[model samples]
Target: MEGSLCDLPAGLRGDYAAAGPDFTLPQDWAAYTPADHATWRTLYARQAALLPPHAATAYREGLARLDFTAGVPDFAEATARLRAATGWSLVAVPGLLPDDAFFAHLAARRFPVTRWIRRPEELDYIVEPDIFHDAFGHVPLLTQPDFARFLEAYGQLGDAAARIGALKPLARLYWHMVEFGLIREGGAIRAYGAGILSSSAETLHATTGAAARRLRFDLRRVLRSDYFIDHLQPTYFVIDDFSKLFGAMRDLPAQLAAARDAAPIPPGAAAPGDQPIP
Candidate 1:
């Protein structure tokens, strides 16, 4: 069926949970079918080849520590490596959790991951995050200290953003940086976000001879900018260093309010095209 897990017969939430842990998988580590292994291999091989010249050094090194081999990763194994590196860990959750729950998890230094993998036919894109996207795309970056701190700060700020009806803009910030951001390393740009690392198409577009403009990380401008949920990103924020991002949020609540106070720009407005700064 096209929807597969998502299309489970009605009243199936209980069934799904009973089938296994509702929030996190056991990493069955050895239960993967040949097909599953092939899927992982296919995705991994493609990204590995494409990311070296394009991906940030931290992301590249994190990928190695993940030690993706021939099958679905053991969350236990992955979490062990990640915890040692940055004290961050992954928690499994049913797909598309409520924003509050999502933020709560992140606030506590835990990432909510969808427990299922995408079917072979649906490899290029999936509506919700899959195991590949969560485990492969996102987890690796959690290994970096600065990125890890920024994520925690993001979560804490999410609470305040929610209270002020600013969660969307805050999420836009996350989408731009943690999920699809590029970074300047030694005077060269490279990919660091999970959304870019896990997808072959975005991986190429982000690094190759493409038409996208990579801008320097500007928190106020980023929160004011709009992003598309259903397509490739029209723009990307480039970070000089992940540490800068972490430090930028020291007063995230105030900054978010400031951005909100500024006249809202239409979604996707270019930085230069924004209303003149007062």
Candidate 2:
């Protein structure tokens, strides 16, 4: 979910307060109309067709276990299948929650997915994440074992970073890596980030787009980088393996504190330590 940044009001007109202090909500699946399902199917069919050659193996493999032949998937159904496969479950949220709330959900192996769907007009772009982006873009990778733990670790790290006022740098890590990252496969670039996975235009651009700067994943460098969220990413960090995310993050807590005041490397520019991909 690319723009899973905006915080939707919790008790608004459409919000459904669920039975938890964590502020979850029922998906209210019955409220969705035929158009919503059609919209989701349309988005899925288009992205699914192109993703095989561009998306990472874990994403593609995780995608295979779920069936999308039907239109939109009910949250309950997706949650059940996901839980059985990797002990991960999706809960409905009004939209993005606070940082702590988001981290708490992920730390518990529960992903808080926005329950609403984008309208037909919002198919190409939307400022906030909807169900299509959350479930379609992010959920598949949760099925992969290594990537799954990395996400859990991310949540824990995010929790620690927040306390020490190092969350801004941490958010940049999430932006460039989780939301808009690229990966290398069989000597080619591929996308694993949900933002790119969900956007057909960005997916194409990430692999072959002009002016796109693809850099090797350097944990210290990435944690200190900045990114643009309102448009296509000008830069993407590429990891050699999904497991590398877990392996390289062992020293994250200490690194975050030490680099808390480090000047951020602007998007599209090579940092002093960055090994540019050519």
Candidate 3:
């Protein structure tokens, strides 16, 4: 939804209480109204139709493991599936978490989720993550073994990067890869990133559009590239294989240490010869 349950459509308001450490998650996860279920169903159906052709196999399988089609999933039930898959569980949270809290949760293998649904009118657009964005958009990909490991490593890297004051560059790498990365499989490009999978409109553009540049995955170059979070991504990095992402983490501690000692680059500036398509 555009905001929170307090801002929901008329039929969606129900007796829900807080469910997170922040005390902003709804307590009544089981009592979601019929409208809430309908909303979940509607969003699920649309994404399902769009995802199969573009999204990765792991995401498709994760959706099944979570029984995502059942409706707006109960956090407890969803956590059970995720825990079984990746030693990670979903915890309820209010909204955008502080960077430290977010990184800590990732480091601990716990994903903090915003436990509210978006309003019907705000289906395709919202300023923050609602249940659909959190659960539907992100939870499914966690089922993959490599992607799951990468998340934990990314969290650890984030903490270290924060200390070095390189969080912006690190976040940019994450933005391009984990959030919107595409991959090559059997000669065709496919979506593996959550941001593209849950987005019904952008999936097509991400895969076939000529407007955006598709670059080979290169760590330093990615950290130097600029992005616009409020709009469709101007460029995307394609991975020849997802395994390379996790492999980088095996030595990530050393790499982050090195990045910390390296000089910072200005935002929107690309590294030498790293020009992305206009």
lDDT of 2 by residue, 1-278 (tens): 11222454444423544424576878778888999889988999999999878999888988877775467778788888888888999888877677878888888999998878888998999888888888889998888887888888888776679779998878877887888878888898999899999999999989888788888998888888888877888888999888888787797887897668888888777777667676
Q: At residue 52, give the lDDT of candidate 3.
A: 67
lDDT of 1 by residue, 24-69 (tens): 4444556668888788888888778887788898988898888986
Runs off by more than 4 Å, candidate 1: 1-31, 261-268, 273-278
Clashing residue pair totals per candidate (backbone < 3 A): 1, 0, 4
Error of 1 at 233 (Å): 1.2
In model 2, which runs have C-alpha deviations exceeding 4 angstroms? 1-20
| Candidate 1 clashing pairs, residues 3+ apart or interchain | 23-92
- Compared with the true structure, what per-residue lDDT tens digits does model 3 show for residues 20-130? 333335436876788998898999999899876788777787888888887888888888878887889887776666566677788888887776788888778776777
The 10-residue segment of model 3 with minimum total lDDT is 1-10
Q: Any idea what lDDT model 2 has?
A: 0.82
Which ranges in model 3 have alpha carbons more than 4 Å from their true place?
1-27, 251-278
Clashing pairs in 3: 1-118, 1-119, 17-27, 19-25
In model 1, how large is the Cα lDDT of residue 63? 84
Report, for every candidate in turn, its global Cα lDDT versus the true structure: 0.75, 0.82, 0.73
